[model samples]
Target: MATSWNGLSSVLPEESYMTLITALAFTVLWLLWSISSYFRCRNRLPLPPGNFGFPVIGQTVEHLLALRTADGIRQWMQKQVDKHGPVFRYRFVGYPMVMMSQPEGNKFIFQNEGLSNHIFWPSHISTMFGPHAVITQSGERHKLVRCHLNRFFDRAAMGRYIHGVNCNAIRHFTNHWQGKEQLVALDIINFFTGSCVCNLALSLEEGPLMYRILEETQTWIGGLYCLPINLPGFRYYKALKARGSIFKLLDGLMEQRRQMIAEDHVPEALQNDILNSLLTVPDEEGNLRQDSFIKDNLLILLFGGYDTSSVTLAMTIFYIAKNPHVYEQILQEQKLIVDGKCSSGENENALTMEDISAMKYTWGAIQETLRLHPVLTGSYRKTVTDLEYEGYHIPKGWLLNWNSQHSHYNPKYFKDPFKFDPSRWEKRPPPFTYLPFGGGVHLCLGYEFARMEMLIFIHHLVRNFSWSLVDPSYDGPIIRDPLPRTKDRVLINVKRVIAS
Candidate 1:
């Protein structure tokens, strides 16, 4: 085959041409060596059954490709599961790794965080979230950060958080949604989640700075889930640029927060936010948490709330339309909440913690959405020491991941697994079999926060308007803007409802 560089070689000086050829040769040789190393240790241990495909890239291309199709990851994983059972080995991005799809594997990874396994994040996640984030930390540091952050994130803080969330949802809908007859749901939902996280986590109101952060956040998310290749024209490069800008904005805010705490002049608006509390709140040792630690956790909340909430809620839009039964039931549930206010002569329509708590069927649909359309495919852990399970040997330092495909979609754990059945949530699935928010100490800190954000927005949505898909015939994979969304914009028509 003729090289694309055929004409370039003729124009180049002879010595330069030879040097270029040498460089190309060296690149090929290095890749060959790197790929060989992944196979060398395989013969030494009973590493689970799998193959290392291609050189350097390994199975990464396949993984990326599967992401483009609906139910692709689970489908791809199922093929390997059929051939290799619950435990299997595969290579991605030059790393030899193992993936498990059984509840046993999920339980083991969660329950043994510091012993058999330790937290590990892939390149894209760690880079985007930063090094000091608790999710990226392991051992004592992880516990330390978790303990400090828990004071603000635990159930006790819910009262302080919900009021702002409630206020924001009402304001957001009034300003952004009420007047529009048709709009892109992805853009609308992303804006709502991003703004809420920033306000609750950083005490920003609707303004230029908050909107700027939200804009950059949009850029950062584009690369969050893609392969971590950093070259130009790649999504990860643009994401890094976005992170730089967002951190600069956050750093300026943090300094102001630090000064406010020092002066002992906390504004009522800022008092409830996690930023104000983190800057002044003492830890178990009576020491204020470090700046980097606070910033990292805040970044985590931003990513966690925006990514997962947007995905689950977007899927909720899809599923509600696809399954009309769910929509009717959810609307029925929401209308009753509206009626409760009228009966009590409450003189207000804002959703409260009590109102959200009453959304049993709606929460069920949310759970069902999370199960079928998780923002993340799974979690990754690194072996702390050489380990053996199911009579297979795993040398220390091998990358391992636990995916929920087998457990979440298996007929044993969920009847007619592919079908969207919110009623199935009435009785919880077996332990460790359903973990959309994960579990153990490593569970997402924003779990409750995300839940509340979703409930409040959904409550407003179903109660205030009736919606229909602008393009009902379309069905395709949810594109990843660092999380699941429709490939084509999911536009919906809404006509505001007057209360009965």
Candidate 2:
């Protein structure tokens, strides 16, 4: 074989070698042409400045590490913003994203509904809320859903639920924390807000059903920012399973509501809660909302109401606990309201819409907490048409994100942005500068409801109990994924406030 190969090599002419070289040159030229053509086609429209990071995974690992830290997602985003202006592009979990932290960018993305109408959610979030969720909808469907849901958060609705919200707050504090030496603020507030939402939305009582739903909802939300792998043990898989169980429970509840309506167990006037309203209310054509629609909106209500409200309440408590002067001011404001009620021969414990309105200082503290630790760090939107901003071209179909933390922390918007100052809110910041509940048409529909809940909770909380941080030396940053949560769950010590 060796001798045969040597003979063949010797017999191969110099012309044959020349032919091989020519073929190799042609192949190289073809490869170069293809590469240039691919780039030219893809770059017909210039993209925002960003690093694609590594292939496939992109910058997902960097993002995950940032989330594990105290500052969480905000720190990672700030670094990117510092390096690459307000509008910079990045890839995360295989999706191309353009993040905007400037007020102009936020206003452009939020107010220009015609150009940016799509809301993007992680698969786990979309699956958990289903297809008909108000947050997931856009255009006419979104407007329709928002109109229906708006009734539940209006002034009239807030007035009707004031008593229920007050009762839930008082009961949770008195029953759960009267004598406890230590309390996990997150756990307690979750139950408080969960119960409040259940009572207000479904007219449901506190029990295993509500508890199960809360548990499953948390499981699902916990995986919203997780990797999108779907294996059995993965977070996203577990979340999907949890979502299925939740939907099953919701289905049964919807069936019961239907049966009650059919049997006339619930009167027309009594059909005021969100579930009943969704089930019984009809469009101009008199067609009832589909059960899936009802269920998805219900899930949205739960998602919007429960975690954000609870985390806000918890942070409020932590801030009050940390700032003695602020706590005292809040206590004084709440005491004045209570004293006024007592002097007028009204029940001091009952919170009316009027009383909640009078809680100006307490509301300020809550707003400050929201500014420092927004429950939703940012929201995602997809461009519907190509847009240009600041000499950068944003092609259609690109993802856009406006971060609350960026606006909240920007010195241009708020002086001493990191300091906790409730008084700063006494004078309103510029439009789009304070976006804890978001801005523009797509602003959070439940903003009023959340504010009312927090205020009512604060009213009862300050009047009944005083709290202090469990570990004064422990200073950890907040975790923003799955909503803004304290690193230590805001552990605190509580004691009843003795009336003089």
Candidate 3:
């Protein structure tokens, strides 16, 4: 039976009918107001011009596809530059963003970070890390957490873990690489780094729990690229589940660490790991950090150690294998360090803070690798205020993206951009021009730790082995594991060389 509007109204009470009409009228009025406000803004302040192409799924597929190769993102973003100039608008997975690719813009973003703009992580990531996690915080809360985190990367803290990194490399090569001739380099690197994080950071020995944490991390990481939909059969859903499982598992370990602290029985070797230190020591104010802070950041430390170190370390190996001249220089550099230790009768193969510092060329090579093949090309920030940038109205709530490729590949900053010259790093590039580890306050807290870890890995790799790329001519088609990586397995033929 088709009911008229009057008939429907009659079926309900008069008061109820009036309430429904009022709700509909309010919704329609609100929509009208919103649409009028949008157009008003459009008339008054123009958005930077560029085609985002379709809503909700705008430009994401194309963006992801472009990032699947080495130099692909640079080229893709360049096309946008060629057409729309450096500062322009685009939609990434429905997020409307303006790409700021100048040193001045980079400076503006970082300088005004807590004032005009702030760190912008999606709700899914914030949800996964918990609301209190460092990645999600800003202003004073972020400062408090960051101050607590400083203890983990101090010189003394790094000194404590130097030998462990060396030990992990030796064990990895012995257990996994000794017999293998041809293998995927990244896979080997990932496992080695995973063990380093587990053993050195989490205080987990080579056991079932260690493997379980690493496995769960993989699932958790997969969710970074997923939409934040909490439904059955979604990657984000699986990622959330994985995050819960990891947190639950970490809860038990945190308890163990607490018990160890209470008993005052932490071994000297175990003292270096961040968790033990975080659990036992008071912060600058002499208060122990929150349990949830320790717990969530354990997730940060473990994953940060792997994702940052593994790819760049692998790329260092990749570039070294592909470029013989570069490899020769690195080999010569590492040889001298080893020779000095042997001459002095120090533990001949032992790596120390001094040894890591002396690795200038090798470190330069890692830096060059980072510049050419950044794990993340850029990061997202949010505007806290409406502002003018490069003559564009970047309204608040829109994302602001600053890409490194702008400076890394810009000839104005680099003499011969796109060339893999480690010597360029001998002198630091101008401010905001080279941001492999990013720059300013948010400049990767893991920077020094990553540097030390990579230097040690290279020292062992160069001194103990020689390798060749499976595809010598392949530059790359960098794939994204939520970060840029070699699309090819980065297959290589590696062989053991002279022991120290």
Candidate of highest TM-score = 2
- Per-candidate Cα RMSD to the true structure, in Å, reads 11.6, 7.6, 6.8
Question: Cα RMSD for candidate 3?
Answer: 6.8
How high a TM-score does candidate 2 get? 0.88
CA lDDT, every prediction? 0.81, 0.81, 0.80
Candidate 3 lDDT by residue in tens digits, 388-453: 877778888888888888788888988887777888878988998888777656777777778888
TM-score of 3: 0.85
For 1-500, candidate 1 gives per-residue lDDT tens digits of 66568788878999999999999999999999988987876655577998888977789879877766547888899999999889998887677788878999888788888898888877777878888988898888888878767766666677667777877887888988888999788778877898888887887777889788888877887776677888988889988988888888989998887788778887877887788877777877899877777767787778787756876887798778778788889989888888888799874466677887899999999999888877766878889798887878888888888887678889999999888899998998899998888776788877877888899888878767777888887677666554667875578887898644
Q: Which ten residues in a row have the lowest lDDT in candidate 2?
A: 1-10
Q: Write model 2 residue lDDT over 296-373, tens digit each, in one string.
A: 788878888898899888888888887899989988998898899899999888888888788888999999988888
Error of 2 at 260 (Å): 1.4
Residue 156 miss distance in model 1 (angstroms): 2.3
Candidate 1, TM-score vs. the true structure? 0.87
| Total backbone collisions for each predicted model | 0, 0, 3
The residue ranges of model 1 lying beyond 4 angstroms of the native Cα positions read: 1-45, 282-290, 347-350
**If both were scored by TM-score, which would come out higher, candidate 2 or candidate 3?**
2
TM-score of each: 0.87, 0.88, 0.85
Clashing pairs in 3: 69-477, 69-478, 70-478
